[model samples]
Target: MTEPTFFETPQPVDLATIAEWAGAELVRGDGAAEITGVAPVEAARPGMLVFFDNMIYADRLAATEAAACLVTKKHQAKVPDHVAVLVCKDAYKSWAQVLSKLYPAAVVPADPGPNTISERALVDPAARLERDVRVEAGAVIGAGVEIGSGTVVRANAVIGPGCRIGRHCVVGPNVTVQHALIGDRVYLHPGVCIGQDGFGYAMGPQGHLKVPQIGRVVIQDDVEIGANTTVDRGANRDTVIGEGTKIDNQVQIGHNVEIGRHCVIVSQVGLSGSCKLEDFVAIGGQSGVRGHVTIGMGAQIAAVSVVNDDVPVGGRYGGTPAKPVKQWFREVTALRKLAERTPST
Candidate 1:
């Protein structure tokens, strides 16, 4: 894979301006100086600045060689007289401002390739097609299916009639979608089956009949779904995803599942129908979630957990039959301690 190129160099900024921008007070140790770069405390040099978020590294303040440092208000006194300190309520916030000022990365647009599309392929005339937007021989596109400037739809990547794709969004080769809304900066890996048939079946007196999947999948911006991750269309309502939710390869998301923003679902994680996960939920690799379960915000499920019940907010859970993270830790610790204490005669 080709590494992306940097767009521009850092613009020089002073500590006073940084302090004003971050709503922090600048407590100077020396004259006002320009910060050209930022790095870890141990790695900072004469022209670069650094940040200290905790007290574990307070002892290293005497040895820091940077021009200045950003520290929390509580830790400001720990800085030695040799270095200047920028005190803020949150050191991380100040660090982010400084980093953004110093190291803004470049944005690269997708390059559309010269793949061929059939003349009869129904592409919306208003859709934006870039250099490498390839429509295959017989695919039909609805109006308002905005193919980002550089996306390629393989011979059969049937984009449902009215989808909006951001720049560089990839509708991989042979994928199918209908009435779906996709955000910008999204990537649909190859063989990804989105807006597909759900495993919905109706039981009659004689046999089981299939229920039609009539809903759509709404994917937010900056999401990267792995290859072959099949997100089933809803049964009656939309299956929605928040921004930056990453679904790993081969994951199965059942109908009407709502995944919150920035959640990471690892490979082979199976979410049954109508599950709701709040923001920042991290489902470990191969975990299975029962249908209609609501996982609270910021919960972490360890790998291979079989979650049959709802998880509380801001907790970590782990087990074959998932339990709270602290309990799981205790169980593992007790077993390990017992093994260590056993006689070795």
Candidate 2:
């Protein structure tokens, strides 16, 4: 049996070319030194490039067997003489640039079939699709839907009535979109359910009266939503996902949520209705923001946190009913010390 290779192998590139692409200085290497692949310092081979940014991995750098490595000036001295060194201000960002040059096609979603629409797909006569739009098998596009050029609607995906998707988008397999307007270069991964009814109801002793959700979802450009994530429609206002925001899998976004540009929401995060996240906010995995709360710009919420109130700008918060990071750490340390000092019964 043979192992599977999903991407094509790249040709060998010399150290000088890699330095040029990464905007790095080849401080301790021959210009002719070449590598065919990239790997971690711990797992590097003779023809692989590795990156080191911290002194904590000094042992790995000291024993690296790779052809070359990318490092900062402060840590370059620890690298083994057998391995060549390329110096850069930001090692991780440089590595990303080098990878982009090596694997150009790896950044985008995979196309399942040709650029033309498959015969097994169903499209209403009122729906308009621009040139180079590909619709795969078992997909259904409803009336008055407009899809732009260079977009691919993959297998079994359904676009409900009056939905508009912009150019260069990829709607993945088994996705459902209703009452939504998606901007250019948006990627909705498999099983993403958009614009569903919100959990709004009038509670009573005998029965619960359901409130009608009458709003839509507006997703801006360069947004990538992961698999099985659900974005519920608002009751009277729109739920907006801002441009360049990246959301991980299994996230639950409640109605009327407003996420600002370039925010990152990790997996299993639950956002209650009307929560607002300002620009550049980062919410870690398994975090929850209470309804009507606002996370200020550039704030960071640590993993498994519960945010119940508004956070000030640039604050880093953690713990349940999340507080400032320094205070949280102090409280945690105090509890641990108290536990250690108390006599056991």
Candidate 3:
């Protein structure tokens, strides 16, 4: 995949001004030194701002050629004399602030331009598209589909019949939406497949009977589903993704799964059928939740965990057949000690 080019080039900002924006103190070197971009310590150039927070990258910090560095007071001593320093309580957070100031998000145009909504696009006459909607080339809008104002349906996207896409939503390239009610400002990244039939089947001696998926997918406002993610439709009840939920790339959300508000599901995570994730639940990358389990509000599941039981509210779980993090750590330590004591084969 080609990297997206930034339309707006960043103009150089002086170290002192950037420090003010990040709420950091300009502690050393010339405050007037210019910084044009933000990068990791090892990759930073003379006109860039870099950050050093962890001691694991101390070597990179010592050798960075950045014009300015965002550092904590504890690590300030490690910064080179020629590199200007902005001292802050949290170097990572301050560095993010600096980057945001330097490179603001580009605004996508709502109106159909020369590159959008080509004559080759197929839009059924029965489809209702509101004003300022941009349907790109090769996009197929089925009959009875309603797309609200300011929504952009990118190239080759397919919106099935009767689907309702709300205002200001972005249906990215190659996305397929069917039997879905999507809310305002939702972002469906490239290759997203919504409202597909779930993995529901009845076992029998003769053959496995496929259960009919009749329910829709209800995606609430401000939800952002990343590239290639799949949200399956419910078998009977509606599968709902609550407001402000962000699902990362390649994540799989099963049928009848109800995820509450502000949940963060990282990349490659899988939530099995009929699972319930309460508000503020965070599942790390590659985690798998068993079917019919309930993860309570504010629970945190570590990366690669296999959760087979209900998790209590505010719990931190890890490991296979996931348990509380503290117990998991103890078990791991005990196993390591036992291995060390055992005689070599």
Candidate 4:
């Protein structure tokens, strides 16, 4: 299979030209140098542009093979004499801006490679099933289930009556989806059970009764769910995942969980029911949160952290009972200091 040739435009741009195009403040070294590629400082070759966003990597930038580099205004003087530097107010932001322009995202079509669809299955008239969308012998789909250009629906991957799967999305083997609106460039790995019953129970004097989950799952664009990651159906409202959210394998999302855009949820992270994680929040591996908690925007919960209450925005937290990142660092530092001062036998 031939991969789509992006970045194949042979327009070799110069350092000064790229800096000007990206609205960066240019510091000249060799304006005539032709830049053929963009890479990291450590891996950049001759004729490529590298970027130094953090101070920790300043020394590495001096030894880089890149003909030019992007740097922050504060760090411009630190660059070596041989390399041309493009100064920007924000190095990371500028780097992202430049790289995005150089290499854009792609959506590839899925070919249903030799799968047979049974006559009993109902494929939507308006849907475009790519190469391998196999309607299992007994599976059914509602109207307007537009499978993307390259999406494959394996045997028994029962898509709900009215769902929209974007391009290159794999309705993973045996996965069941219902009453959901999925976005483009989405990937659903095998055994991913979406729109399932929520774990809601009411305990009374007589017995415990289960609360009916009447909500659905709304997975947005550029989302990739790991294998077997089960997103429970909402109790009353939809469980929403913002665009570009990547969920790792074996993660369990409870009912009514609202995960904001671009969040990275690592493996085995269990979000309790009704937890709202705002934009750019990162949940480390094996992290678990209590129900009804709100993790504010840009907050990071370290691996294995147990969040029991609401977290503030931009806070970094760690430990079993999660605390502020600064506090966690201080506790570790104090412990180390105490050990150093202790009298040994």
Candidate 5:
């Protein structure tokens, strides 16, 4: 099978033009140099634009073969003389601007195309598909499913019975959504599994007894779930993902988890059952939150942190059994000092 391509063909843009678009100043090299693509410093070839932000990548920046690079004033001198430098306040932000201009999001066609429902798709007669709804080849729409207008259910995807997906949502290829009430403009990437049974079982003499997950998954508006993420259904109460939340790949959200508005959950993060994340909570990659914990609004959990208790509002936490950032840092420093003081045999 042919892999789906989303990016458009590269368009050549001059150094000066890119600088103007990125709100950067052309500090060095030829302004007329044409850049055809964007790449990292290590892999940057001629006619490609790269960004240099960290000093740790100074060697890569110095060896880059790109036509131009985005850099801050402090790092401008580190750039090779042969490459044009686009100096900006924030090199990463400028690079992002350049990338956005070079590669804008593809517009989903309203008219039927490869993304549209194929003749091979199986849609139950009882299902209600709104106007312009696209179901790709091999997709299965179960009985009583209601899909809103402009929603695209991709190839090999499955929407189980009674699921209600709102308008302009993209249910990517191989995704399986059951017992879910999804709101508008949500994007579920490929391999997403929503509304599956939660990890709930009773330990008894006759082994574990499976507890029935009877609740639904409520996904609010503008939420985007990354590829291969799994959201389990609740035991009795609904599992809710609040509006505008962005969840990264491979995340696992347990039963009855309540994620508040605009929360950002990075890749490999796991939220145990019954946890409540208030508005604007940010969980970094590989973080795990224990069950029944309440993370207050605007709190940030550092990567690899183990959160086993409640987090106060606007706090920054890190380390195992997560605590305030400052306290964690002090503990780390003390441990390091103690280690250094110990003599080897």
Candidate 6:
């Protein structure tokens, strides 16, 4: 199968325009030069923009054929005379801005065609869609669903009955959303399963009794969930994902897990039932938090850790049962030294 261009073709932009977009000073290059694309320093060609932020890539920077390079004040002199140097406080941050300006249509699940709504989509007569909403082919909008203006329901996505999707949101292909209220500018990537039944069961000697789950999933504004992540609905309350929180792919969030605003949950992390993560708390990849535990504001849990207790505010924890990061490292070091000193058994 041939590859598809999901983003629109970027137009050629001048050096002056790129400098303004990146908020960088055109310290040593012709402002009139035109750039057509962006590339890494190692493979940059003429009319392409590149970034040089680290000294480790000095060799690559010296040999780069890019028309212009986004660099820091410290690396300005290292850039070749033939290349235009745009100095900034943070080269990487400025590069990000430039990329966004150059590729404005690079959102997940490419925009549906010129027409607002596709004729092939199955939208219920009772569903209320605001103006300019785009429903792509094979998408199913169930009864009583209210979709805000400027939202795009990508191909094959299903929005179940009574669900409310806010404006400017992107419901990616194959996404399944039910019993949820999604906020504005939220992005649900492909294969994401939202508002599913939580794992709630009562133990018994003969058999396990299933508990009834009746709560919804509340995803706040500006939040982006990665592909294939599964968020379970609450048993008796809403499973809340707060504003601006970003969740990575394949993460499993159990029933009643409350993630606070701006928290970052990395890939493969698991939060058990009723656990709470305060604002700005960050959990590293593959970490597991126990049920009913609370992680205080600004706390960080290191990668591959198993958190079994409440973590204090602004603390940094790691390891199984997750103690303070510093103590955990010291114990690991001591154990390594002791093993080195011991003779063979």
Query: CA RMSD for every model?
Result: 6.3, 1.5, 2.9, 5.7, 3.4, 2.3
Decoy 1 TM-score against native: 0.65
Instruction: Residues 1-345, candidate 6: write the lDDT tens digits.
Output: 999975666889999999999999999888988999999999988999999888999999999998899999988998999999999889999999998888867744555666477899999999999998999999999999999998999999999999999999999999999999999999998999999899999989999999999999999999999899999998999999999999999999998999999999999999999999999999999999999999999999999999999999999999987999999999999999999999988
Candidate that would win on TM-score: 2
Q: Pairs clashing in candidate 2? A: none
> Residue by residue across 113-232, what tens digits does model 4's lDDT show?
556667867676765566545565556666766666556666667887667777656676778887677887687877888888999999999999998898889999989898889999
Residue 328's C-alpha lDDT in candidate 4?
Answer: 84
Please give the distance, in angstroms, between residue 254's alpha carbon in candidate 3 and its true position after superposition: 0.4
The residue-level lDDT of candidate 4 at 48 comes to: 82
Model 5 lDDT tens row, 147-232:
99989998899999999999989999999999999999999999999999999999999899999999999999999999999999
**Candidate 3, after superposition: displacement of residue 41 in Å?**
1.0
Compare candidates 3 and 5 on lDDT and give the better one.
5
Q: Which numbered prediction scores highest in lDDT against the true structure?
A: 2
Worst 10 residues of 3 by lDDT: 106-115
Rank the models by TM-score, top first: 2, 6, 3, 5, 4, 1
lDDT of 5 at 140: 99
Of 2 and 6, the candidate ranking higher by TM-score: 2
Clashes found in each candidate (C-alpha, N, C closer than 3 A): 6, 0, 0, 7, 1, 0
**Deviation from native of the Cα of residue 7 in model 5, angstroms:** 4.6
Clashing pairs in 5: 117-135
Candidate 2 lDDT by residue in tens digits, 184-211: 9999999999999999999999899999
TM-score of each: 0.65, 0.96, 0.90, 0.71, 0.86, 0.91
Error of 3 at 199 (Å): 1.1
Question: How many clashing pairs does model 4 include?
Answer: 7
Tens digits of per-residue lDDT, candidate 3, 41-60, equal: 99998888988989999898
